[model samples]
Target: MSNDNAAPSSSSAAANGSADSAAPRRNSKRPKYSKFTQQELPACKPILTPGWVISAFLLVSVIFVPIGVASLFASRDVVEVVDRYETACIPAQNRTNKVAYIQSSANKICVRTLTVPKRMKAPIYIYYELDNFYQNHRRYVKSRNDMQLRSNSSQDDTSNCKPEDLINGTAIVPCGLIAWSLFNDTYSFSRGNESLNVNKKDISWKSDRDHKFGDNVFPKNFQSGGLKGGGSLNESKPRAGGSHCVDENCSSTNFQKVVWEDRGGSQQR
Candidate 1:
């Protein structure tokens, strides 16, 4: 009877213990938020509304607006400067009207008078482009041919002077007269004391009291025996110094000296 009672008591104790063990553990992941310490929980904030979103958009605009505007103006300034030097002072000529139109595109570039700002770091580039313009200016065959003839005569040391008089008063003409002449011979251009040499010589020579053109003219005695073997040409060396002066008869003439003065001017004193 005692053993039966002991077995029943033991079964009751085991049943109570099983019920306690089945209860949910406090540290399990299912409801872990409840176990979080006060310091471990994230702080809560109010939900964003339409007003907050609008305010944020205005804040971004205030920061970037001035930056964009400044950049636009800077770009425009760069474009203006480049355009100034790109166009021609004279517009391109066309078939209808063969004359070129004068247009002021850039300040004329000159070496001595380099008046324009040399902001360009690459001088070789500037020189190349300038040369191209000059070549195009000379390509008009008919116009250039006529202009060349005129240019040569315009600065002719013999111009406006009678053959009888070696020294004449100072004559002033265009600067292109000297520039073109030297360019033909040397393929370069320059302006300096040499540019005004013609006037300087003439002015100094005029101070002589006695001046005659015939004294400066070439003598007719030295004509190169009118070509050989029936050729109507005169192969003689023209004028003494080989200047490009020819008589109305097409006879070659030479210069005694570059100075324009009568042959006997120094002896007159």
Candidate 2:
């Protein structure tokens, strides 16, 4: 009862529909070879074969191996000196109770003499290396008023500098645990008999002088004899209303320092 002509027509229509569903389209991800595109641009494609790679590596090695060896030999001439001073400085009997001895108003001076084997170069650095010391303690660090230290107007600003902040009623200018616990220990260098002249001009950063602290700011009531913290500040000079020489030392002698060394190998206490 099916017509052969109708069957052929249905089959042709199905084929036509399937073809129309998806017209021929190029892949989006695959690069097109257009004249303006880089894929079709004229370029030198240097093929790095195994032989080429090996040759390049060999050439680099040949140039660098001699240079590296020479550099190693030159570096051998440089030497670093690390002299242990704690054991040599502290007394034998007081070793048991070092805290008591150090805290007490007792003379704690020790000297060491060293004979140099080789000539030390110029621009040599001398620095302190403390053992069993915590410089980044929470309580020690946060006890500072940046506002008080920076400007003369903010001299009364002692919110952060507690305990050591105010003496009686007056606020300490450089009020903080860090400033209070400055380096009491001093280091000086001498060669033969002539004492070496120290250049402390570059001890602090230029930015600290220019930005961090104002020229008008000066020391107020640093140590009021309650408890002498560490190093003494030059608070004798009176501020004369302007950017005169402010008597305040902000060098990190213990915590951070890289001082110019004297022409000697000995480290004295």
Candidate 3:
């Protein structure tokens, strides 16, 4: 009886092993269906209707109306004096050929008398404005190397400012149309022959002078190209404070100019 049972058990084991081996295996690399892949999961989606759109507009108005009114009220105390001197500053004889006038080394200064209705309080600001110049154009926008500005080590990394990027393979610091065409205008504030002390110290953005631009970085081959733009930079000094005041496009009071650098695009004002 024991012999018969052992033989039957061995035969059953062999049959089971043979059956398992003979079954076809599933491919491990095969993709399987998933609810996520098929996008069958439930979600909350907002539909925009006429009522919903109107509600959104009302909500924005409710939140921003007070802020706008408050801003106007606050700025009312501040006084701004703007002088568009591009045309007035230029010598009448050279108005037609402003490009040549700017390129020349001749003195570019004009005194324009300004009448301020309200007295400019302390911390009087000065500004210059531009018209008909597209500083945001694609070519002008991409013609800068921020890496070079941020770090002294990356001065050679001027791949963006092509054409103005280099001079005989030497990279330009602050290379770009923005930097080349820097706002080189100089202003002297005076009220009836009394020179007001224009406090220029710490006027620029603290974050930019300290962080955005590297302290070790200075100008190199700037305005050295065939066609020079607005300004020239000091070679020995670092760019921290040596650079021209260009944090903004256009500010201060009723003032007269002693000297103004004629710098801008062909169509600039």
Candidate 4:
């Protein structure tokens, strides 16, 4: 009876071992779906046919050709003339004089003759370009007080004007980079035999519409005389030899002369 029971137990153990080995083989033989492994992911395969390539080139040419022609014609119409008078003024000689004359005659004025190659069209615009003059610098630009410009008796805002704004309770009228660094260069133009006139007052913006400085608020210590404190810009003056003041105090004033020419009419500077 013992031997019979032992034989049955051994046969049952062998059957369990065979079932475990078959399970692994069945899992390995399972078929993998091609849709889940490869076909589900996207891929780009560009087909660059000659027709598509030719169409793109034609579209670009159609849009840009007319634009290029129009730009060329417009550029041809404009005629610009520029003259930089680098060394126009000649220094005066003082070799003999012991005292050395402080203000020399030569340093006062500089005159140059510019001949135009071709006559410019009607309404010719003239501008002076200062290459080294940096008006956009941080220290030079933010040197003015807006409150002081609008008010005559207003105290100096030290944060804006710094060491110069408030000297002894008197407010520096137009204290800033714009007022300090004033352009003093003057220009005159003569075309052929006719002397062109430049209207300086018209070049600046209208105070009523643009500046809007209150009537009560007048520039303090303002010099009315020719370029003394800062020239008086309110009055209209001729573009001739006279020094027309454009600043409230004509000390350091930008002397920009704006000239306008009419078609077929006498030239108005």
Candidate 5:
């Protein structure tokens, strides 16, 4: 009996061991939140009250009032003279001998009479405005190579300028759309029949380096000279019917100066 009892106890113990081995143990540590759900862990919320809104509005008004007033004063002080002569001038051939045609032709001359309504402070600034000319066109903007400007060498990738950038294994100096389509427009200004002097020097941006010619290039390689048998790179001509007087001084007189041509006209302040 004792032997049989001992055998049953050993089998029971083996069975208990197998059951413990088969059962899964619970982990003591907790899992961390995923990066995706971590953002939700932080809780911050702002509640706006009527008093706070009023205070913000008052602060904005206090800051903006002076700025607005200064801007208005500055704008009022500036005198801008805009003459759109390109669309104003009617061709001589289009005019007839009739009185109405003669009157219409007279109206074609763009003349703006300016009388200062108030006494503005000394050193009043004047600016001339031009319209209908797009310098930011895709063809005009992408016509230059940044590498050529920065590195003094043509870019191996000429995708920006394409066929125009490369010629005979040489990169064109100042290669780009702006240089390709140069603004050839010229203007003349006058104050009360006396022609005003226009200072053309330093009119262009200083960033346009003169060293674009590079050591290997010559002055004749520009638009004036024949590059690879091409007569001229810039085909645009200066519009006729305007007189350009450079570096001339004029007498002070207030009268309407007629700008008869399409080139951006001059202004007298």
Candidate 6:
């Protein structure tokens, strides 16, 4: 029984070894990912910096601000400088010297001009002063003096001052026409007030020679010397026409001379 058992065990071991050797060796396969080409990111582009923009703006301001300021100041100075010859120039140009001093204060502007002379006095035409409402607070003053007149004429005697160009016996040389035009233009620019009609040519002056051009207006309560018209100086009780303060003889008063008034609240030129 032992021999039988031993023989069978040896035969089983031999069979198992044969079975193990007969089986084929198999290798395991691994899972694989898809094959694709990788894409590269694009390089960043250069952008404008905030600091550069700010620096450019600052540079422009530095260059232009001073020039703008200088130009403004230069124009102001030029206007003030030209205001010195109000009275002297009018008489020198054979034109009458006109003065307009408004009453009281409201809407008041002191206007004066240098009248351009007649044909005999050509080339000596002095443009009347054309000041309007103040542009700035900077005042300009010119005092009364004969020296400011620019004329080589020995007939410098301003005794019987001629009225501004007016309707002569036959000729209609409008009085204060040029001066009125200038005053209107300048006043409009300075004040921008449309109602202040300083340049209206339609309005008539009651008196030509005796009538003064102050504001180119007649005082409401004022009476005119009757000469022809009822409320006119020409038809006053007696003929009060000729010129301001001149007697019926039309004698030369020598007071007809124009003198510059105060400027900047002080006398100058």
Candidate that would win on lDDT: 3
List runs of model 6 lying over 4 Å from the truth. Answer: 1-49, 65-169, 174-176, 179-269
Better of 4 and 6 by lDDT: 4
Clashing pairs in 5: 143-176, 143-177, 144-175, 144-176, 144-177
Q: State, as a TM-score between 0 and 1, how close model 1 is to the true structure.
A: 0.18
In model 5, where do residues sit more than 4 Å from their true spots?
1-31, 34-37, 40-44, 90-139, 145-177, 210-269
**lDDT (10s digit) by residue, model 5, range 143-228:** 65555543423434355765366556655554444444443334455768898565433232223323321222211123432332
**Tens-digit lDDT track of model 2 for 1-269:** 46978998999999999998878876699676787776566879999999999999999999999999999999987766777877678899988988777778888877777566678887566655656655577887788777765678988998878778888788886687766765566767777897866544344444555556555566778867568776655544322222233325333321111111111112222
For candidate 3, the per-residue lDDT at 178 reads 67
Position 72, candidate 2: lDDT = 100
Error of 6 at 260 (Å): 16
Off by over 4 Å in 1: 1-44, 72-269
Q: Rank the candidates by lDDT, best first.
A: 3, 2, 4, 5, 1, 6
The list of candidate 2 runs beyond 4 A from truth reads 1-74, 77-79, 237-269
TM-scores of the candidates are: 0.18, 0.62, 0.61, 0.55, 0.48, 0.18
Q: Write the per-residue lDDT of candidate 3 for residues 186-269, one digit (tens) a residue.
A: 667687768877654444445665666666776788888788876677666566542343324112100010011112332111
List the global CA lDDT of all models. 0.31, 0.63, 0.67, 0.48, 0.44, 0.31
Report the lDDT tens digits of candidate 1 across residue range 63-108: 9988899999876544212222223433344323322221222433
Q: Name the runs in model 4 displaced over 4 angstroms.
A: 1-50, 90-107, 151-159, 167-169, 202-217, 222-269
Candidate 6, position 184, lDDT:
20
Point out where model 3 deviates above 4 Å: 1-76, 241-269
How much is 219 displaced in model 3, in angstroms? 1.1
Full candidate order by TM-score, most accurate first: 2, 3, 4, 5, 1, 6
Worst 10 residues of 4 by lDDT: 257-266
In terms of lDDT, the poorest run of 10 residues in model 2 is 255-264
